[model samples]
Target chain A: MDALKAMWETVPPATPDDLARARRRLIEEMGGRRRLITVPRLLVAAAAAAAVVIPLINGLGTPAYAVTKNPDGTITVTVNELRDPAGLEAELRSVGIKADVSFLAPHTRCAGPRFAGVDPSYGTRPHTEAELKWGAEHWRSLQVIKAIPAGHRIGIHPEYIRPDETLVLEIRDDQNPKVLWTLGAWLAEAGTPVKPCTPVKD
Target chain B: MTSQVDADDATLIGRSLDDPEVFAALFDRHAPLLHRYAARRLGPSEAEDVVADTFLAAFQRRGDYDRGRPDARPWLYGIASNLIGKRRRAETALYRAYIRSGVHPAEIPGAQVEDRLDTLAVNRPLARALLALKPADRDVLLLVAWAELSYQEVAAALAIPPGTVASRLNRARIQIRHALEEGD
Candidate 1:
């Protein structure tokens, strides 16, 4: 057993080029962009409300999201149901987080922005013909950006937002055949702190 | 100044959330060993695929990584193990080829001429034993014996309990011993 282990260790490693190529591919796929400013204050406020609710559409037929300006200089957007992603984006922009929202479908059968590489092992099975057809025409525009595998509804790569730029996000339905249910929001300006709402004296 | 090398995998993965290129530092740290391990199981060509697939999968799932565990070896090895399992036939074929020709493609040439015969004598029986074991047993046994992962680490890698790891290792060792005795 010891000799076998030694022999196995003796095997040559991957070439330097292979390493470089793989790294490059990952960077490209993960969106070759810098980190988005993390608003810890907003995350704390929103975390509690982050839950998956079925029948995304509210009874009133309006988009389902709660956008509030936190006491800390950040805006909290808790997405309960993804009826309209663009509506949520509008809500965020009104609070001043210049953000763009897109829902990332769980199945990649859709046509959208091309990433350099994707983990083939991840995600559910391939899309059906009907779903693939829907994704083809609506992929770039469908609402959900975050997939269930991501374990949250925040968005795909929200960190890519630049201090001076707008934030673009993609969310996805967690259920199988995860589709874009809403076009959340697109905040025009990012990095600037949201003003705390004036405190109301009781 | 904390160089990337000085940082742990967890920290590196965290940094990657911001400056993704920083994630490449992780590849530099572990890809070599990972490639070697894969090459041992499968040949160099498939090993290359295994290395690429492992890191890429890890990169995508970096957000879900357990930061509590500072070392990424078990996680990385775990991902690589799955990819290698998909190519089980290739792995078995490599071992069978080595048994037949007594030549491993990745083996260093002309060195250890004296130890070559002894290494082959043991490796042949070891390969047969490995081939004969059930997939689960093979995973447990190789992770410990070949990857040098501890029982606890194997549990983390295979997502099994440590006690289960011990039982599987015991069973695998017994099978290997019996196989070697038969060869004798």
Candidate 2:
């Protein structure tokens, strides 16, 4: 014991020169990192970008998601792959629902306030774990877009929606099998138009 | 020209959210001993990468950091330990080589070779003892011995309960004792 503890006591603490490269890397990363992934902050900027580039999953032309009308008169959206956001939005519109959809790449999200929201539910930013838990608790009861208890499907209740109001769905690829993507769902005001999804660099 | 000399680690981390270069104060504060600890286990070369990855990961996850934890050692070392765990072969080889050559590649060999044979007789066996321990047991032992973290700190670092830290430390110490006794 004492010998084990004392075994390498003589190995000196690293000098500045020893850590210069690592320090440089850290400094470099700090400069290039544009966003801190606080849940609420990104949700606020959901439509902040003016660059209108809808993401298309390259190499495949087929639709990446399916919108099925459940037997109970609710809609089930199963997103098997993250591709063709515009096509998915058009699909929802054809089914008597006006929707704005953004499929975020990993470590990316659109800025918020793209349109005036009907309520504060559009902002799901939680800075800490405690806040995230609190947000999840309240967001669970959201009537417009309820994340179904299973799979990549969300149960959309058309009755809960109002006439002329758009369903704004910002789903990002979390890249986790269990949780899949982080979905931000809220309603744009009945008279207000929701802008295209803007990508916020994280 | 150093600022925030009086700031607590949590405060520094919080401020780094806005003025990110302020994070350099944190890297400056923790990196030296962290690098030394990594160098001891993984040799001087790989230690650099581990230290770099630890700080970068810490910076990214700074948003999720609990401002309540005043000292950042448990968080920083926890990240470093995870990085080191992935390079377990390098760590084991470091110990094995030290035992075989009676020289840790990172250590400056004693001034007189034959004159320090007595020290080698003791240190070499200790290195061999470290090699024979299980990786989890070794993690607990080194965090205690090399990093000098308290049981609570080790538990926080490894995300284990304090009782488990105590048991793992005891199991590791006994193994070290047995390996040394057998080496004799």
Worst 10 contiguous positions by lDDT, candidate 1 chain A: A116-125
Which segments of candidate 1 are over 4 A away from where they belong? Answer: A32-34, A38-202, B3-5
Query: Evaluated on chain B only, what is the TM-score of candidate 2?
Result: 0.93
**Candidate 2 local lDDT, B74-181, one digit each (tens):** 999999999999999999888888877777766766557674676787788788877888888998899989998999999999999999999999999998888778
lDDT tens digits, residues B67-172, model 1?
9998999999999989988999998898888888988877767767777777777778888888899888888888887778999899999899999999998998
Model 2 spans > 4 angstroms off: A34-202, B1-3
Q: Score the docking of each candidate (DockQ).
A: 0.29, 0.23
Task: Give a tens-digit lDDT track for model 1, residues A1-202.
Answer: 5644665566767777756666556656654232222222223334446443333335775447777675654445566665565787688777665654554443222232222111111111222333332322222212212333222234333343345555544444434322323222222233433222121211
- The C-alpha TM-scores of every prediction are 0.58, 0.57
Q: What is the clash tally of candidate 1? A: 34
Point to the candidate with the largest DockQ: 1
- Residue A170 deviation, candidate 2, in Å? 26
Candidate RMSDs in order: 12.7, 15.0
